[model samples]
Target: MSILETTASILKLMVERQGAIRISDVIHHLGMPKSTASRVMSQLESYGYLEKDEIHGTFLPGPLIMSASHLVNRQLTLNDHVDAALRSLCERTGYTGYISMLDNQEILVLRVIHGRQSLPVVTWPGSRSPAWGTSTGRALLARFTDTQLHDFFASPQVVSQLTGSQQDVSMLVATVARTRDAGYATAVNESVADTASVSCAVGDPATHDAVAFCLSFPQQLATPEELQRIATLLKEAALTIAGKTGDTQVSSPL
Candidate 1:
């Protein structure tokens, strides 16, 4: 990797670990000469991307990191709105709720709410779930171009469920097609056993990225009629969230 890329990789590692890393550690991770790593570290330090604690002799994220992240998280209000929306959805529906957005190749859970009655499902905040295997992921996948969809299907991350309900790209694509036609997506025990969810995309008002609001319930509790009503609520809530959040794209779900 180029020096710049290497520096960025190092920065990402440190941020993920949330721990101080020494110069020797950086060299060991990168498998580069000490002199090269030292040069890269010096440049990063000069650029205010990293700071070394003199006493510990280890580097940590510098002020610039927080400033840049603040600008990003500030723009989406991702953290702020996610928790509020999740809580409101769970309260309204009496089911677990979550909001997710496509982050790179993964669907990232921004917030989650567990309702009063405990369900068998296991989920958490800031969790990363596969976009190819869940209803929320399929909601976004339906909107991708043919080439993008093909590329995503080719990736190894996509997996077939043991439930024997749906398998292969054709079936998944067909499901997305139906979701696009219906203006929402639903999966019954697709991700977790005995748990189902319905989701609708939260279109960005500005850049038009596909975001989603999801409601999850026990398989027995989520009847067809209930799902139909929940679908309406989810659609309306997603649009409301987008409008209130100043999302850029005004396009409704298809």
Candidate 2:
């Protein structure tokens, strides 16, 4: 889509929903770059077309959307579809489901569903966490090719933005490679001490709309074999969610 078309599409997505939206939402829906989404959103905010919620990290309709005669069209909100998928998975598996999306080097929790077992670590909707340590983060990162992964993690910043080459990209790439081989990703004592998670990436990484379906709980809840079974279910849900979000090009489930 052209820049104008892209901007219009994102704005439409924002106005169509009653709630706020994040840059990650625009990326997921439109397959736009983080830089581009930021730029467009900045422009919209400056023009009074959008308002930012600093605390919640979301965007809402601004003065222009409130008063202008701009066209409002219906489009499937990608985050909505993912959130629903997470809910269904949590119901079936009895595990909390997190709908997470990549926003640069961080993974943002877009939705959260509570299962029977409460997580030892707190994860709230719209919370931002490290992509390097969490299964949800690694699952989304696994979408990148090795070279892309290296470039993505070139900087060792806690945020992991491509800056000074201080990060252990090799190790991250190794973990990602394992995710590629296993058709899923897992974490133990990485995101939070004594917490574990299993994750699967949804849709194509090339789309720039990277998302992951993850189930997190206390570390001792499952053994390797049991975790595999849950991972199987998570992978299936992630795959189905790709089609639901209108992104049929998904990460390989095989």
Candidate 3:
């Protein structure tokens, strides 16, 4: 691979780990010669893309990378709207609500709003969950074309992990189809046992940048009718956010 590509990969690894990484860890993980890895590390450190801890002899993301991330986040106007929608959903349903998006084959939680309940599901921003094992993941995945689904299932990031009744790609495809048909997705004891959730996709499908709005509650607390009601509320919130963002192409599950 090109030097630039290698450097970017290393940076991504550091970001994913969210902590300092040793030079040896990079060399071992990337399978690069010690000299080559050292050269790359030096270059990144010099350019302020990485910072080394002198005492621990480990590297971490530097100001430059953080600044770039901050700038990009600032430009994401949709986050503001999504956050407001999450709060509104939580208030209406008395259930914890979240926004998630697919990132590197994982479902990355972007924002969360706690409801009136005392014992809401505990998931933090920046936490990731298996894409095939959660309501939000299924909701987002339902938007993928057949070819994209195949490619995603073939990737190394997607393992043999099964959630709910999905044992193979065919079952996963069927689940996506059901999610599309229902205008939402549901996960009961899939990601976290005894937890139930329903989610709907929001944003323009053409941009391939949709996010899922989800309502999570204790399984025992959610009757069949309550689940359906929460799903309706989630869909409405998603549509409102999509409309505000001028994403008229969002598929209507209704």
Best by TM-score: 3
- Where is model 2 poorest over a 10-residue stretch in terms of lDDT? 69-78
Evaluate all candidate structures by whole-model CA lDDT and list the values in order: 0.74, 0.74, 0.79
Question: Across residues 140-220, which tens digit of lDDT does each residue of candidate 3 receive?
Answer: 888887788888878876864443444777887799888877879998877777788899887753344678888888888
Model 2 per-residue lDDT tens digits across residues 208-246? 466787888788986898689888887777766664443
lDDT of 1 by residue, 111-156 (tens): 6777775678767767887787788887777677778888777765
Would you estimate the TM-scores of all the predictions?
0.60, 0.62, 0.64
- Which pairs in model 2 have colliding backbones? 156-167
Quality of model 2 by C-alpha lDDT:
0.74
The segments of candidate 1 whose C-alpha lies over 4 angstroms from its true place after superposition are 1-79, 159-166, 205-210, 244-254
Better by lDDT, candidate 3 or 1: 3
Off by over 4 Å in 2: 1-75, 156-167, 204-208, 245-254
Count steric clashes of candidate 2: 1
By lDDT, the better pick of 1 and 2 is 2
- Pairs of residues at least 3 apart in sequence or in different chains that clash in candidate 1: 202-211, 204-249, 205-247, 205-248, 205-249, 206-248, 206-249
